[model samples]
Target: MSQQQTTLHVELGDRRYPIYVGASLLSASNLIAGAIKGRQVVVVTNETIAPLYLDTVLRQLPDTMLVTSVILPDGEQYKTWQTLGDLFDQVLAARHNRSTTFIALGGGVVGDITGFAAACYQRGVDFIQIPTTLLAQVDSSVGGKTAVNHPLGKNMIGAFYQPTAVVIDTSTLATLGEREYAAGLAEVVKYGLIYDPEFHRWICANRDLLAARDVDTLRHAIQRSCEIKAEVVAADERESGLRAILNLGHTFGHAIETHMGYGSWLHGEAVAAGMVMAVRLSAMRGSVDVDLVVELEQLLVDLGLPVWAPQDMTSATFIDLMALDKKVIDGQMRFVLLNALGSAVVVDDVTEAELTALIDG
Candidate 1:
């Protein structure tokens, strides 16, 4: 039998595009070629991903279009200005012009840096996201917030540029390492925790199936996640207001990434630990019940995600690092905390004393 397919649209008016979700989408030449705006195409992917799926993607492009490939070293640590510069060198060496369309063909790191490259290249160019990992398919690939990480904070330098299309081939997940696959679940759980209480319950009930990578379950999770994220982006493309809630565990998570050094912990693993901290802080602030904290932590643990912050880091260190977060405004650190199981809010009123106590405990 043939596999199913799903499509969602990001309503950005003139900048709107479609997100195609299905199995074997990499084989769909028409879907990929139709999204390209020009005859010149550059595919930017990481070393780990290149050997696995690059040729398949290349096969999908129209023969008439000129194509070039840049294979970057795979890792969160490589999401830097230097690596981005390397990508630019390849584009320039190939003589790719402003009309070139760049294709990001890896996970979140590749998607972010590639999209950022497209945004800055010749003032701006078109790009498509062909995200392989579940994390990228559901979260990073849908949102146009692209950036390279800084030593001080994650995603400190970037742009709010949307993509021409997001092609998600679920079959690619089969190539993901177990740890990476589990890491992606952190973002999946985030959607449930922040906006869909029922989805949270669904995740809890289907934990085993999801961990096993059941196709139907994986498809539903990815589809729903894209739907929720697309809706949020449509309402606030630049994260001016409502979109901030999407940063649920990111403040703490970004701190962990910076302090631990990027790549030490997978983005989703750091986010899993960070979500626990956010929930605990919410409880301390009297916004949520302690039981809710335990529940969320249990869920993360069951999913093979870490629920504790790194033991080596002190509370003060976390506070200092978090001050560098992109969400900080006017010297106040903004946090996205849950007030209930499914509702999240962004607030900058978290006092140092409260944060210190929570981190210390």
Candidate 2:
């Protein structure tokens, strides 16, 4: 963008891509054009975001580019095999080829589904991440972690497909409702908690500015989160080792999502609550301090994020679903627990007895 932007590059071998974060990124067509390897475009969005941001994004594409649009139903409940399969059906019917570029034009669900479709289509095709929500900008869009939920587990079926480029328009946050904005902030808070204590403290200090979508504060938050995520994804793109640490609160969070049913709670809301549970669990194990748990909870509370699982879910159900989580390997459940703020460890050594107490409490 001629507006003079600070560009971030994700170096992933031959699949390297650039992430541009600034104002009017979608309206800036050359930046978008620079990312795509070929001309054909398949813009996948949903009913909710279509009327709002789709056209503005499409306006950026050149008249020579053939753009096909697909707007699916809105909500996480629809992030399924059936939902994702529709993109394949639509694209394949149109005879989309290896050169076809899929553009994810909504929030996480759209990004995950579109990226997964990109991974599988023609044995793999190029896709762009145009993450509209704050959560997507900070977490989903940058990383290549793509997936569709299974009735049995969250992200049970998916692929790791990097985007050709990620275009994040900070302006979109204005339309996000308070609850939805808060949900996205949960991920932002996560980046701070898991990796950068300095960023965590910055978030704490700038809570008001962030809540108000102050550009300078928001830009810093988004950029730092992407930097942390890009480094992790580079080291362990498939999440075999170091990358799993990114799932700090996800193990418990995914369980709540499964038992409650998807979309009932926004993913970030569930993660915020889940992180609180993990901290509490860690403290009860006699390792983590109680004060840290409370402080973390307070930060989330300040952001208007949920700090507890839904009252409707039975602990027994929560446990059962967690057992089936993708993190479970070698007949043991692996959890990413904090050693302290801004650092985490994936421990598989916690006993069944200890786990039961954590969930029961």
Cα lDDT, all candidates: 0.91, 0.86
lDDT of 1 by residue, 183-280 (tens): 99999999998999999999999999999999999999999999999999999999999899899889999888888888999999989999999999
Give the Cα error of residue 97 in candidate 2, in Å.
1.5
Best prediction by TM-score: 1
lDDT per residue, candidate 2, 1-361, as tens digits? 4264668888899989889888777776477777777889999999989999888878877888878899989989889999888778888887778898999999999999999999999899999999999989999998798999988888889988899899888878888889889988988888877788899999999998988889888888898889999998999988889999888789888988877889888889989998887778778766678998888888898889999887766566766787888889977888888787788788888776676676665
Relative to the unseen true structure, what is the C-alpha lDDT of residue 63 in candidate 2, on a scale of 0 to 100?
88
Residue 156 CA displacement from its true place in model 1, Å: 1.9
Off by over 4 Å in 2: 1-4, 312-315
Per-candidate TM equals: 0.98, 0.96
Q: How close is candidate 2 to the true structure, as a TM-score?
A: 0.96
Which window of ten consecutive residues has the lowest lDDT sum in model 1?
A: 1-10
Clashes in predicted model 1: 0
lDDT of 2 at 352: 65
